[model samples]
Target: MLNKKQTNTIEVSSDIAQVIQDGQQLVAYMAKDGQVSLDPDLAQVMIDAKYKLQKKQWNAQDEAHFLHSYDQLAKAVAPVSMESIRAISRSDNDKPSQAEKAVAWYRRYTLVALICLLFVQVYYLFGHALAHDLKDLYESRNEWHLKLDSEEPNSKEFKQIQSKYEEVGQRLDANYNLLKVWNRIWLMGFSFGSEIPPYSQEKLNVELRRLERAQADANALDNLNLAQTRLTARLQLFENMLFAQSVLEVLQGYVLPLLYGLLGAFIFVLRDLLREIRAITFTTDSEIRYRLRLTLGALGGMIIGWFLNPQELSGLASLSPMAMAFLMGYNVDVLFAIMDQIIDKLRGAMAANDGSKGKSIQGSGNG
Candidate 1:
């Protein structure tokens, strides 16, 4: 039942507004007498606000009010540079200020996401292209096969082609033999046929044993043929063609979902990365952020894939691109909620560490 806030509006209660105002006044006063140092905590709050509010679209009045309200406070923060403060004040058109930062982030974040997705798409297209190119190259090479169990080939070229197919067929047949025991098990357990007679369990067990023995025989034959023919190279090429097609079907059908998954995960991770980067201090290490990004991205890929995976792409089962995009968007929002929780945990841990160290330092100095 945990809930996460997507926006940082904070309700801005009268008390908090007063706090911000007083903080602003304190910063301004401190700036005047060569005592320009700001309370780092107050500065950090403003910096946090900048990042938290960057997602929202603002207007000229909002930007102007923000600067007018806290420009001094903004100047106090460590990473909250003068350029950031000036950005708030430069234009009354809110689009160019905080709002524009959000837009720029959106654009850049999306571009990075699309790049990951494009890799998935490329994986499929690349396979198909390679298959076609290889097929053409083989044709041009005029590849020929030598026949072993030649059944009177119609012509030399036909015999070679037949030999190739026959070799593939033999491998397939051998593979089927290896799989026969599994098939027998399936048949005994659930084949579509008349009901088994009484004591069928014992009968099925016997049948399976018989199948196992048969499979061993087939495997022995396959080995003998393999040794005799030395057709491993040609057979491997044939197998590659079949393997590539099988792979194509999988990648082609699932590529869109994979794209969605990868992009969704990237979105989930990137926001956290930005937050972590913005939050970095002498205490916050980069390794933690990187690992955190990976963990969250992994979770996002699973969660997003679960909810919005492209299940079926043919006929009425197919999803429109807009729908897919929208679903991905919805998942991103959920991912953001998860990110907030992680950030909160990180902040809590960092705060505790600081408090414990502060007490230890004071105790040592007193001693």
Candidate 2:
């Protein structure tokens, strides 16, 4: 609402105030021993300007004369003084507006939300990995069990399978301990009254010992088979329970990529926001843009997860889908650029197809 003349007056006033303050600080700096040396004439001019400014009797010409003297003194004594004055002037003029304050307030809550979301994603990811590893161990155990069934109890192959099975069991026990800890800390409520009872590693070990003892008795071979079957069934049930608790089906679909994308976007936003705050360049005007960027990042991540197969790409074969999603989210311009390239390729292919169709029709008509 401020007109040009009023804005100019305000600017001049601000500049004059800054000049006065800087003059005082420069004089103080010069007073300090071995700090700075100013030409006598320039020093006098600075003193006169400071006096005039303090008395509020400085005209435009007086202000200009003082600025020229300050510049000369700065060049001779402290080269950085002029730049510091300019920075101070900028800082004074660019005070945070109401909108910026509001944005800052909202950003605090946004930060909290992002942190909470990050914790959840990390928790789910951990659970997913644990469940997956446990499933692999269970499958390996099943394979070894099959091998044991085919071998004589006292044979080398049987002993080897038994050894491998025990190793797998030890790993399973370790994983079970981890699960117990995880459940104790995170799933206390779910654990207390859950319909799916927790697996007992101690009972499983007892059953295994019983099976090993009965393996030498030919009459108890059927009992051994039954015991193995029961163990396999229990292991399978535990695996299912783990996968269920992990929400593996949902995570494997699109949620994981979305979460990773959000994480990437959050990281990028936090870094950018901190930089802007440090630089004193952050404004509410860009807040909406940041939110949009975050949304785009999440979408980019989901898109990458759904369509982009890293294994299919030559150099990207080692990167996982989640990693790709995160990268896309962190820098959505990359995703946009990639999509543009894909669109161009599709358009070119369609054009070629259309041209070929036209040529074929013309040939048929001529024939």
Off by over 4 Å in 2: 1-125, 143-246, 271-282, 307-320
Off by over 4 Å in 1: 1-98, 128-230, 234-258, 261-316, 320-326, 330-367
Q: Give each prediction's root-mean-square deviation over alpha carbons.
A: 23.2, 11.8
152-222 per-residue lDDT for model 2 (tens digits): 99999899989999999789667666655555544443543223233554555566678677665655656
Instruction: Report lDDT per candidate.
Output: 0.51, 0.67
User: How far out, in Å, is residue 37 in model 1?
Assistant: 38
User: Per-candidate TM vs. native?
Assistant: 0.30, 0.50
Model 1: colliding residue pairs: 59-94, 60-92, 60-94
Backbone clashes, each candidate: 3, 0
TM-score of 2: 0.50
Q: Write the residue-wise lDDT of candidate 1 on 1-367 in tens digits.
A: 1222324234444544454554443454445432347656655654544543454433344444555546555444545433433333336554455423543655586687688667756666666666666565455334333333344556676766776766665654454333332233324644223333456445555655775777757775665455434444455455556666666666544555545655554565456545633432212233344345544444444444344335543532477543454344435555566457768999999999999999999999999
